[model samples]
Target: MNFFEQQDRARRNSGRLLILMVLAVLSLITLTSLALGVVWQLFGQSHSSLWLASDGAIGLLPSWRLVGVVSLAVIAVVLLGSVYKSLQLSRGGQAVAERLGGRLINLAPQSLEEQRLLNVVEEMALASGTPVPPVYVLDDAGINAFAAGLTPQDAVIGITRGAISLLSREELQGVIAHEFSHIFHGDMRLNTRLVAVLHGILLLGLIGGFLLRGSSRASSRSSRNNSAAAIIAVGGTLWLLGYAGTFFGSLIKAAVSRQREFLADASAVQFTRNPQGIAGALQKIGGNLYGSQLRAGHAAEFSHMYFAAGISRALDGMLATHPPLDERIRRVTPEWDGRYPHVASLSLVPADASADQRAVAQGWDQALAAGFSPASATAAIASIGEPSAAHLQQAHQLLDELHPALRQAAHHGSGAQALLYGLLLAPVAGLREQQMQLLQPLLNADLMSHLQALEQPLRQLPGNQRLTLLDLAMPALKQLGTEQAATLCAVMARLIRADGKVELLEWTLLRIVERNLAPSRRLSGHFHLLELADEVQVLLSFLARAGSILPEQAQAALAQAAVELPYTGLNLLPAAQCDLKALEAALKRLNQLQPLQKPRLLKAMARCIEHDGRIEVAEAELLRAVADLLDCPLPPLLNTTSAAQVG
Candidate 1:
């Protein structure tokens, strides 16, 4: 999915989450409110003569007041408990993202091929106009990969050592591309959200346990045994109810995430146009003794998000997020004998083999890739439309067919320019001498001192923190303006090229860095090739109208965009037609907006299209189509009624 679709998904999800949160809050409120309602009834009833047993009996007002005070205390306690639970869940999720991102992995870019994997990942980030995510090598025997992060800026792609050693470069490319697709789409955010929601759900059980233990202790020490017994019983009941919530929450968490894995697999195949890479990787997983299981302490908590099965032994279909390995393999390769491929057992190889040996290995792989007929491979794998099979084949073909030099070139030059920029800016080592010079002049002595203090810590930082550091530095870089920014990019490119015979990975990295700094440059390549409309009115009105559409309006808007941007093949209609629940949410957000503001919002979007003097026909058409669905009127592209008025 594109940025717009991802944003719409996020907006819808956020709205649903907010509603869930409100309901949870109300549920807590209702519990206390019910308790208060009981107190109020008791207070009102105490005024009647029937409440008093005798003249010596305690006055009813005192008992009513005592009851009211207890109700207030209950409300306060419950509210505080709810707030604490929310905060704890949020904290746990952030901690996970930060810790995962900040993790260090000792991966040597030993071979040109391994370096290329880094370059391609970096290149894709540039191509997509996002930062290069941190890369880590898992030194395990398993052949698996996974991407993790709360945001694109803070994401990480990790692969096992076995994967690197066993798979050909083409196969690795397909695997990495699959992981990158997860980064580009809305998967990261949803994954993080799942972590938080699951934590909250689980905490209910913890809370119940805590309260029950405390009440049990208090009851043992109390003089009034019956009253103490009553308190313990209530606490025990609440605890049991909370456990039920936890049970359902865990099921929901696993269910929601499982299907997305299949979609992610498809997206990977789409990005790389190769199936063999992923298929080979999966085949390797099935053949390996260690398999794809992770030994990390937090394995089960993150099971749903891992690239392969984390807990191999605990494989229940109901709880397992990943489908069975045989099923996955069969889906990718229908002609498969259920038996595993005959991969020789791995031996301890020298980390730095002779240059001649490396070249021979590389040559052997290249010859194999060249010799294999695409048609033969296609026959070996299932057709593309067969769930995962066709897509996996395409990815493999794309990876295998590309010349190593061209693969490297794709990492550098125009194809990978933006992603390179994002990566270059991501780390201190990537900063060009001139870019640093420009930056140094802008900061005051105190800030420079602060920078000096930070330098050591920054240098020691891991992938995610290093990216975060880049984000922190962005506002300062933005201060450099267009001309200076362009100059900085040129300097970065030269630095990357300084070693002579620039590698494709290096070029891709530079490109990604440039794009992150200048998002407006995203469609610039297309703009150069296409003729555009001279008037801004058409584009502006179209976007304005499209922005006002209901959730259900996405399909119509997408259909319109598809017609406008003919070649892009943006599956807008499918993307726009969200589930029914999403429609209600869109209506809610629309309802909250002031009528005047909605039009203004549309106009602002229109203005974005009209920033350049001319708008391409595709751009204008897409904007207007979206605007039309938003229930807004389209003004004339040009006034034809009166030339005098136009003048």
Candidate 2:
């Protein structure tokens, strides 16, 4: 599926969820109204002498106004609860991990298992063209993992201890691939929203518990029989209603979560080109005594987010968030004979020297292969969110090719800062000297030395490798204090300006880093394409100019793109008018377009870049950068010869 189309579908699902939530709320309102009606009838019956003289209608039918008031109160309670929980979780995936008692893995892993896990996560990030997310390990001894965040930038991957200790490296990679699929599919946002909505439904149960306790204490303290009885009745009613809410909430979670698990499982197989890897993990989960169960008290709250059902079901699997293990395995490994595989204790496996050398050689070979054609460019666009085995192989090879020191540097805060600064240093001696001069005042002497030392290696790196290193450095760079981050941004801005010209690569690198590091830079809205046509035009013009060397070529690219967009009167802006500042502004606005609109924009972009019937490395890099800026995880554009091409 096209990345934008998937995003649009996710948005639609979110809308459907909202509609379902409204229906649920209405159901709760009706239940509450009925309970209140019974309470009113009982109250009248208890005061029969006073009610006997009045109209007997009071006992038969409850007051309409009272029902109305109760409905309003229930709606208010549920909405307020959901909003409060959503705001709390706005801190992002880190918050969810911490909530479940997960410990963040150190950047420099101390254990072989931790190191292996980190490597797999890094490769997945690189292959998917997303920034490397922080990894968290739950103490729970279960074979489960999850991805959580509102967006890829803030995303985190969480794995159970059992997954690390019980599964082989390939199995672990499969699990990680599944989690990354969730991240790519935009499932985390929906999962978080589900968490918030469910919390709202569960609030009634909490309130009931509080009321019951209060009533019990009051009855013991005084002889207020009538008041005590009244409290007991109300609390008892709410307690039942709370459970009713939970029942429906669990159903909603189950409905939304199960199918996604199947998709992710298939995606994992597609990604690794090894169904047995994921199937083996599943079989092990089935055979192991623990069977993917979590000990955390909050496990049930986010059970649907897990790679498998993280808790045992007492309802005969009715409330299970994931599909049956055997069934899932059957889908991945169709030849399975319905047998569970016995998992042994995990052992550390040493890296193969020959394989490493071969991968590194292969990486360079692939880099120098023929440049992409128009068909390849279109294929690359389609490959977004659907990374194949080739992408995984490329990721592994790229990681192997990176200098060990640079890779290690990407894992730590201080080293990551130096790496970023080093990448920003210009190749020209005069500009490099000026950048160093600007940095000397802001950084300590040790940091300055590190930056200076990394320049030569950074200069020798390939374009894709450079981007991969930047992606790897994201989690570590995120550890910087606000002041330090701001300084880094300032230094980068100065370096980009020192040469008096902003190369496309330089601008893209700066944009990627800044957009990720600074949360305020994230644009949040859902406007239609027509509503943001001017912003789209500006962005398309900048993209066209970035892809072509000549003004006429740029104009031609823009013309190709304009035909795809529905808007008329769109034309290429002059090179002076389409500067980095203008492009940045345009991106900020385009980021606000609705999910469906983004696909159209991307299609147009592909058309613009492939107008010359060739996709140069610079053009491909720019396209990937633009895709990343738009929150789309585009796989690398490998050289291909095909008849079909993207519009």
Candidate 3:
């Protein structure tokens, strides 16, 4: 399945999860209410005579009001707990990582292992045209990893110390790709929901346990046998019901999680196109003593989010979030002999780091990318969430090609901000001076000097490569405090408008900067293509104008895109109506297009970009920006050649 199809499936799975949660809650309510009713009958009404009345018959039924009250209270508690947790995690994956006892690795990492890990992650992110996520390492001996967030913008990758120390660079890449697959396929959001839903179910047990403990202490003080016994009975029953509900919740999580693990493993193979890389990682995990287990107390809470089962508890065979290691290995490498490798800690520096760089540089000349042209719309749609070996190699080469100063700058906070300022400086001397003057007061002496020192190289950089620079800078930019990020956005906006016209690239860069500060949340996509005529018109109109100089040429482009749009009364919107401001608002509305509808719209946009018979640097940037703002990942691979064409 493509990203859209996978997303649709995730949505369906979420629906299934909701149904299961409702059923579990209903079961708890019934069982808890029934238990409480019996307890109430034995105490409030008849005491010793409740089980068998004085006449030797059973006591009266507990009042319906009591059952109703108990049920309502349970519902309230469950809903409150679920909502609270969902909101807590809504802050994004950073919160989840912190809770797992993860320490964020700085951009300028302290060791070879961390540097290697970050390199692999950056290459993957650029190749896939996804934002480079900040990575964190857990100080644990477990061989495991995970990707967590509601969307790619806020996603973070996490790996354990043992995995980083033990696995080869290739194997580590495989594992990281597996987690990226989760991000691409919409599983991160689903997994986050699972954590929240299960937390609610688990909360009931916590509340019950607290009540039971409090009641026991109260009973000790009261020295009243009858009242204490009744209170203890109620508390104990609630605890049992809550625990039973949590048991079912675990079952739900295991069922949903296991199937997705298989999909992710398969996707990792497709991403790297080397089954052995990931299979080898799995083999080592099996042979290692700690395996994939984590010592974190909350491991069980987020087990379903892990790349492997994070907890090895009793009944793990039934409750484990991941499939057995042997099964996973066999699936990835069908010819496996069913023997796991004997794992041992390896050198921190990868064997081929230097050799790989030389290989990428040499291989680039032979790549088919030099003669590349934009593919058809369907082909473009197929490339979404899928990156090939060639793309990976090119990503490697791109990193290698970056100026050392530029590359190093992107790895730190102030340096990254300086890079952004340097990229925004206009080529025209007057406008550039205007921008520099505008920046002089807002920026510190250090930041101003940094940008000025780096100006020539950044300005000399090709337009196609600027986005790659932005991708590299995102992780550090995300490290900015709220006030700092806000200040940067304000500065970026002034910089973009200082020239009296918003260049498409400038507008795009500013939008991207703002998004990285606080990534936009995705819509559930209930709206369809037919429902978004005005928004479609605005998009096609802007795209048409972006690629063509002539009115007739723009019209042709608009018509080509509109052919795929399948709507009535569509027109090439006036340039005044389709300005950057309007296009920005249009994209927000268009993002609501249904899962199936999104690909259709994206394909139509692809049609517009292809209508001119060629792609340009500015045009490619515009297309990429639209795709990104709409939450669709478009690989930079196709357009690596776009640079050679006009950039």
Higher-scoring candidate on TM-score, 1 or 2:
2
Candidate 2: worst-modelled 10 consecutive residues by lDDT: 349-358
lDDT values of the candidates?
0.46, 0.80, 0.82
Model 1 misplacement above 4 A: 1-102, 105-117, 126-129, 137-144, 160-168, 213-235, 312-315, 341-647
Clash totals for all candidate models: 44, 0, 0
lDDT of 1 at 215: 74
TM-score of 2: 0.90
Indicate the worst ten consecutive residues by lDDT in candidate 3.
362-371
Per-model TM against the reference: 0.49, 0.90, 0.93
Per-residue CA lDDT of candidate 2, range 497-572, in tens? 7778777887888888887877552344588888888778788888888777898998899888887788767788
Evaluate residue 464 in candidate 2 and report its C-alpha lDDT on the 0 to 100 scale. 59
| Rank list by TM-score | 3, 2, 1
Give a tens-digit lDDT track for model 3, residues 1-647: 88889888888888888998999999988888777878877776532223567888776455567768888999998888889998999878998999999877758676667777888999999888888998999987778999999999999999998888888878988999899899988999988988887778778788878878888898888877777777678778877888888888888889888999999999899889899989988998888878888988787888899888888779888788889888999998989998877765443324334423332222222121222356623454676787766567777878887777788899889899999988889988888888999999999998998898888778667666789999999999999999999999988888888878788888888988898787767778788787888889999889988888898988888888877776755677788999988998999999887777788788778778878676666666677778888888887735545334323
On a 0 to 100 scale, what is the lDDT of residue 159 in model 3?
A: 90
- Say which candidate scores most in TM-score: 3
lDDT score, candidate 1, position 581: 30
Tens digits of per-residue lDDT for model 1, 473-586: 332343346676687677666555444444333443343345445532111011210222211223323333344345344334434333333133333322234322333344
Better of 2 and 3 by lDDT: 3
Is candidate 1 or 2 superior in lDDT? 2
Clashing pairs in 2: none
Top lDDT: which candidate number? 3
